[model samples]
Target: MMSSCAHPLHGKSVETQHKTAATTSQQEKALADIAAETQTTQPAPVAQNPLLDGLPASDIAGVQADAKRIYSNHWGPVSERSRYVRARILPILKDMGAPRQLEVVPVAESGYNPYAFSPVGATGLWQVMPGTARMLGMNAAKGYDPRRHVEESTRGGVQYLQEMYAMFGNWPTAFAAYHRGPGNMTRRLAQHPWKPQDGLDTMPVPPVTMTYVRGILGLSALVQRGLWTFPEPWETHQVSIEGPIDVNQLAEAAQIDPEELYRFNPGLNHSQYLDSQIVLHVPESMLQPLLANAGQAAPEYVHAKVRKGDNLSVIARRYHTSVHDLKRINPDLSTLLQPGQTLLVPAGHMDSTSPPLNPLLAQGRRIHYRVRNGDNLWNIAKRFGTTPAAIARANSIKSDKTLHPGDRLWLLARARTS
Candidate 1:
């Protein structure tokens, strides 16, 4: 968040945005959730072991590939971020009786940036909307967002996650619920049978939520193998003071540069004092120095969570940044934008006049399919770079209905990339 560009966010940011956790057919998912026709006894999304349990070999392979892709491109910079907050997060999860692997959730959420705020209004490491934050007992009102405080937000996130695990009985579904939102997940679950035989990855979740879960697992696995490393981390240290304190004076007392100080304290919107005795987050090293004078640490990266219709060029222009810079930071970002994906960028002076992206313009393109002789769902799926199940689900194909020459089997509606 730059002094010139950081705009005050106004509402709930959707993760899963575009309130944005949409699966194949929200209508059907909703109907299934309400109808008795949905599956009743689904197997756990992840079996007893969170990592190795219910995922198929092919799915694991896909996750591994994505892990390597994201890791190879993003690990260097983001690793520093994850490592910096490692000390603070590990103890919190451990105290709450959560698996350490689960810690990767925040890393994937916002690159461990407490100042990470989405345009849609999601904030903090968990990327929770204000409504959800308030519901979870965190005050998100102006001048009093506990979500900006790492420790407080971490507790809220952990509690929510623990609850999700209890409800879903597995990590995959729990993680999905975290991103997909519980209600959306419930609706999605209504459509999916707990098929342990097919594995959790095969479940027809929104692509973004599915990716979110896989990345968490991938990071956890990579960490377990000693392949991931973060070093010489610095984190913010908070001190409550009586009345608004001059950021300049505080920065001087803490023996820190003004820019660095501001960087550490995203809560302080200006260099001057304004709040009546707010807690200030300064560098831990600055804490003792700051206390000597009556003080300090800092972490934040400016980023935008990709919306359904956003493209690199569009996102870059909106932030007053160039596409090359975005690509430089996000080397693995696909040409197509997927909701819930986060892309880092320079938080330099933002231009407010930028137009919002229009999903209406990008709404799925139509591709008609008149069945040819000898063609099957599997063959059609392979040709279209999709799945037979996806095509079947899209068309609502009856189990007994068979395809024949000249028969019409429409391909799934999808966002246009090309």
Candidate 2:
């Protein structure tokens, strides 16, 4: 224990320490070299635009591809359509607190054409389906498909999108639901839970949905980045009209080309006559003239004298109107019918089986009336302010039995013209 001389074991221990230190240094240097090589070979992360909101950076490639496609292949027509509708649509989105970029939806769905109808019955600028349109308070019935109305359909589509967003909690998922349907998407999402980090690429949706999502995102991105710009919008104003008016007459009154008027009011293209009261869109410049013409138009309601055995239902059926509408017009009306008591009734047309209430009450300027379903001489004369005998005489009609739909008849002008 007290030996002064270095033992042989001590020298071996020092030599072993030195050899261990040298091996550790060599391993550290090799690790550093490997780290440098790896850094040099790896690609940099892609820079994402903040406006993409819920999309992940991994979607960049697909989004860019779609954006490029739109620019190259769809720019001209898409831009034109976008320019036309942005004025009408953007305000709605703004009022609803929705994203402004939603304007691109019409561009993708219908190229902003109000008349665009899908083979599956999706219609209007937003391409809403008939069932969906009906649920949104649009009249998608046989004679009037309001889904072809630009403002109505856009509101319906945006409301649907908003509902989807509420359900999914994000735009991408909401968009997927919009395409695939809420029920189907809910089922799919139940099977494969959505992960925001992984984005849509990893979602269990069809390729078409994926493409649709990417295209919408791409278009929105382009707008956000100023790579795409909507041109100045055409100015328009709305005029509320009591209708069943001729398109040509309306166009003439507004001093606008009939085709241009049709372009502004494409939803009425199903028939030449606008069959009900509607807020009609027109060029701003034509608004004043249209207003003036509307002022001079015939009254939509006419006075009727309650007669023996006459009831609200009977009168409503006689005029092709409803008791509800009759009550709405005559607020003080009671259930009891008092002969010689007056009530305001809608000056609506009567069908073949129903006789005119008071044919003599018609008093206004003459108009060209196209015979519609269930039209008879008495009802036609009552509608156009002429007597049944006068109509028969002018048109050379032998009897009311000879009248048919699509028959053109000229009614004699009323004694007191407007």
Candidate 3:
């Protein structure tokens, strides 16, 4: 039967009661490990200067007003939602080499509510469109949108942000592109190119897009400056299941309430049984019991050395597995693969007939490039068909900063104009 459990994070949500068991020594150790990994620390200090440059006094006042409104009226729901997912989402953003400040994008997008659905077909914590989800290598098939899956959707959202950053060459423009369509942003920028000195206020984009960018920046600043706070993150660990398993049976085996299991796994809500390999996030204390009762043999893992031209997609395809599975097993995997780095993949014979790489992903492959004399973000972006903002973001440098010869940068193979 489909789980009728209401999400605990949502308003008036039904609470799922689970039986409490005494903490065994092994489970206690596991919980400690999870705490060390997932607990939130005091955030790094925020820069005293405003996030965006060249804003007039009017724009500055507007942003402060927005931030105040969010802090006063929306903190309850936003903080509750953010606390649930912040621990998990932060690592994904870090893996993508995105600025830690971007973690608040979901807070601005959907208040970090995974089930949040917009009238225009945007869904999930990131409010990603179905078409955009597919472009990011998600399964957006009928009755099964991985966009609702917290981990999968976060990866897709970050990928989209990275793509937009590549196209526009800066966070404000990228945020605008994410809100409006990239095509529209491109046309608008062509008519009025972004000048660093002029700031985001000068952009001829839609008011809503401008508001969206401002909101994200404002919210980020509040949290960083200790004016706002999120509750402690719920400690959980992602466990991979290799094949179909009935929900009731699986929950019983793990000694968790069915409703609780359903609450943690919204992407599996469409069916009673998970018919394919998938990742499940379980409470940290339940990790050992779940593994003990799994009934199946331990999963085999194979280590693969990173190659010069390799990416998660290429490695996953070769192993006949999905990138999600690869990431679940290797929690520390970065979006940019470095030669000689090792990764753990689910054991499978190499598939010579592996399907072609997704076209969208093929265009997004990254390569390490050494900076040469006279090379700058603009020239490098032009050569790679990306933007100066994109090069700067990937390399964690200011777009207008001078590049020194022998410095290294990671460049996307080719950014899609669309």
lDDT of 2 at 172: 73
Candidate 3 structure, TM-score to reference: 0.54
Query: Which candidate tops TM-score?
Result: 2
Give the per-residue lDDT of model 1 (tens digit) for 1-418. 1001111111121111001112236433532442232134332222222543444444544565567676567777676665445666677777776776666676677776655644333556666655566677764323434555556667778778777767776667777777767777788778875542355557668676666777877676555444555565565676776533455566666667765654454333333333245566666677776667643311112445777788988888777778887888888977878766676665453222211111221133345677767678766655443467767877888634678987776664321110
- Candidate 2: regions farther than 4 A off: 1-51, 139-144, 253-255, 269-271, 292-418
* Tens-digit lDDT string for candidate 3 (1-418): 0111111200111111222221356534543542343346643433333243333333433555576665557778877866656788888766766666677777777767665544333556777665576566666332234766777778777777777766665566777778877888888888888843454578787676677777776676566655567788777888976543444555676677765665466555332222355566777876787677665433255456777899999888878889999889999888999876777765455222111121222334466877778878876665454678777888788888888998888887442111
- Give the Cα error of residue 13 in candidate 3, in Å: 38
Q: Relative to the true structure, how large is the alpha-carbon lDDT of every model? A: 0.56, 0.58, 0.60
TM-score of 2: 0.56
| Local accuracy of candidate 2 as per-residue lDDT tens digits, 322-406 | 9999899999889898876677776555122211221121223344666778778876654343568777887777655567787
Winning model by lDDT: 3
